[model samples]
Target: MIISAIALSLLLFAAGAPAECLGEWSPHVVWHVAKIGKLTSELQLGPNGLLYALCGNKLIAVDENGNKLWESDLPDGSKSGCPVFDARGSIFIPGNALIQEVKLNGSKGWSFKVYQGSSKAAALLTTGPGNLLYMQLPTGLYAVDTAGHYKWMITQWDQVYNASTQLETDWEILASVGNDQAVFVIIGKKKEGYTLMAFGEGGKIRWRYSLGEIKQANLVVGGNGRVYATVNPKRTDDYYKGTVYAFESDGDGSPLWSYAMGCVDLTAPTPSEDGLLYFCADEKLYALNQDDGTEAWYEPLPKAISRPSVDENNMRYYLGTEDKRLLALNTEGRLDWNLTLDGKVSMRPMVGPDGYLYVVTEAGSIYKIKDEAPESDGG
Candidate 1:
């Protein structure tokens, strides 16, 4: 009989709970070693089922057994951010002034020159419809086709009021693509304000919304064409006061709902398949209803949590913490297990295709944890 995720979690928790209440559930480590160089990006599972790791300036692909498949050196010997894969399975690596496309077999494809005469690197990379690639820079957004040819570019800037000169402020652009292939970006002007914009076909502006004077903000596009942004209060004394705002993706930025969260240093909100949003801040994990931003549940953590990875089939999520521990939580926001690692975990845990958990530590060690119980040896 198939047990529900909550029931399975309870059974596992009872079987694995320690005397100290640390919830230690030690899964068999398939492999643990510092194979890659100082890891600088979160591990990503590609469509080909190989684990892609960006370590320093090298991009390495490894199989489930930790066997090296191939490796490629990035341009300028460094990466500005994590790489993204297109619908055709080509990996796009962002660098200063260029975005390089690499094939799965470790060969180089065309390099698209996104910026001219500026040494500034791309802040984010995402894929859009029609096999198009989107790159966000401090100044503008560029859309390129699969062959690395420019489709369109958006360079318009909005004025932000600041004490200093009303100069064009460099924006921290956070971008994500929706199910409809529309590109959504949240522009956080330095010490000024925030703006949300949606780009449709031919890079046309579909909608724009202004969030006045937010100290920090992050954006995510939901499956149903809704944009969600978590904004922190701008005042230094009100650091813990934050809000999550939901807006229709296509309209004139009309609000759907807003939820107040006593969150400090909030991570990006992650949307699950069941219309729930998950985020962590101030050593607590919260689940909110995506339709109305109502509280679903929350659980406190021993340390600050990183971004979580959800397994939809099993209805569970995994996250790492600053205190060198990996945690697995059920959909009900209950702790299922926790395992202490060698070093602090700064990135989200990656779930491989074969149901193995892959994690990397700040000290550069990579580990693969089994997701299922091991078979018993007959005594």
Candidate 2:
């Protein structure tokens, strides 16, 4: 099932343009605290209105007021992308050897071993429809139900067409649940390039699309049913050339449009309320037409761009830089304000329910900042 209308509305609004531009903007730090261990992944807002931070081998839960709720250790090292919250309010952390479930009260629920062999690295974990949890292992993808029962497992060996060539398959980097409840994964083949595959409920392959020689891939599902992927050049010396591909959500895997970029977009494409796709790359923020893949506008940043996050009201877009700065941009692609952090920010800033932006630095510091302007006055 899709998210609730209220939640979807908020997401669309945040991704979309604001109703109007702001006159002046200022942000002030409300609170700052040091985490227990080095943050391993981005901060995820839980269903209980608490923020969960993966720090080394531990999971730390903190409130909006910067109070620590609870801290617990996972079964194994958690190098997975991020922990996801299921519909039942439980957090699932995919570790190297096992998948650990934690209840909202900071208690362990259950643990399931993903693989029996010595290698136990899980690259990605995401929630799909039917209350199912999807995981990406080195061998392939596995699906588990809410009760922690293994539904089905699909490996690269099962999907390869030619057995004699012995093509090597790379680890899955991106996985997302589409609007139709199908699971989408991007995998790399040694000589044949990259393949985007959609899997049905019973571990069946719905469709697969191939793109040649993709060095970096970032995927995002739009507010509409379109799937957007940014593929960078494979050669490290030439990172400026890239392409953005849009796929239909109906499982046919047909391309809607492909837009070539002047620079490689290392970040995922974000959809705005106005149906434009936004991404940061090479010290600039680019807005593209979602339907036709045409350039709408581009805004230059003071430093190389990092990941970006949109506010709930679609009023501002928050982004970080390699130069230790957090920036807020209005819908018109103009800079609203910016603040320098203690260290460089590699991750996107997360907007909390308490009307504050939670930013994490590379030095393991977390800061909660609030806008000095009033919300009603469009600051």
Candidate 3:
């Protein structure tokens, strides 16, 4: 993944150019909160519209004006998962064998023990409908309600697979759908030599798909209500290869479609606007039809380190390269403009709803950059 460092440094360099101009936009820094801390996760927008930054065991909330509101300590230091909010405006954070809630005032609120005898945490926390919470540990998946009452739990995966192992598997709950049929339903995929499984309400195993032939897998839920998996096969080549697989989010059976690429894509398939899936492989950009996994097109470019982030207002794509540079690609898969940043973009440049680009660098600074282009005025 780090192989593109030198080649990417020489690629396009442009500031924030007008959305109309195909060339470049000179970068205009609106405001930046510099040297915040060792940022552990991407900046997440809180329910009250404040920006939440998770730094190890601490949580900091900052307002839109780059002013710090409050800083609080978490029960356990987390290396993954962003803070999620419930309907009543409480924050849910993950920790060792437990889930902690914090009120809007930054005071620690309630706690729920996910596992009876475990201290190891997967550190993955997600919220579903009715303020239902989902927590992932190395051992299993558990759910709790808004009042911290335990709901359902799934820990018998070895029995689900009809295979036993004393060692714990890191199971990530991918994109989920919550409705009448289930409180929070999910289709999950595990790492190297992975297994795909779908679980509905009460931790019922709806279906499972075995993909023992692959070496790695990533799952993303698309806007079209289906789960997409890009798996890499065990190979002897220099490049890591991945094929895209599509599965219905609510269905009980087989994958709808699969598309194999001739080149290599080590990242998960990025779902862009207008029903397009974008991925970079071997200095080339490829787009696929999200519904059927058909190749819409492919174009050459500098290697990409991060998946593309779609600017919904102007319909453009932004991606991070290996040499701390940001590249912009037009909707048609052509280079539009790029920008050089202070450090390897710790997180992909996110196009904010307020029409500014929010970027974080390795030095733990959140940069608010002007996004000049838009498909329509006053977005």
- Highest TM-score scorer: 2
lDDT of 3 at 378: 23
Stretches of model 3 off by over 4 angstroms after superposition: 1-26, 116-121, 129-131, 160-192, 213-216, 233-240, 262-265, 281-284, 374-379
- Candidate closer to the true structure by lDDT (higher is better), 1 or 2: 2
Kindly list the per-residue Cα lDDT of model 1 for residues 1-379, writing each as its tens digit.
Answer: 1111231211111121121223333355666655456777678778787777887667877666665656788776445567888668788887765788888767888888744334354556777656677777776678888888888876644433323333332666654544354777777666667777777777777777776666667777777777787877655344446878788866776679887766547777888898898888778888889988898888898785687777777777878889888888765778867777777886878776677788888877678776553253311
What does candidate 2's lDDT look like per residue over 106-140, in tens digits?
A: 78888777543445456577766566888776567
Q: Give per-residue CA lDDT, model 3, range 1-379, as digits (tens).
A: 0111232222222333222335644345556676667677667777787777888888877666666667787765766666778669788887777788988768888898754343454456766434578776656768798788888776645365545544345544443333333323233344444567665666676676765545546666677667777776676244434677788767874889877755444456678668888766665667888878888998776646665678876787776676666677776778766666666663557777777777766766666666545443422
Q: Model-by-model lDDT, in order?
A: 0.70, 0.72, 0.65
- Compared with the true structure, model 1 gives a TM-score of 0.83
Alpha carbon deviation, residue 98, candidate 2 (Å): 2.5
Location of the lowest summed lDDT over 10 successive residues in candidate 1: 10-19
- Highest lDDT among the candidates is held by which one? 2
- Order of models, best TM-score first: 2, 1, 3
Candidate ordering by lDDT (highest first):
2, 1, 3
Q: The CA-based lDDT of model 2 is what? A: 0.72
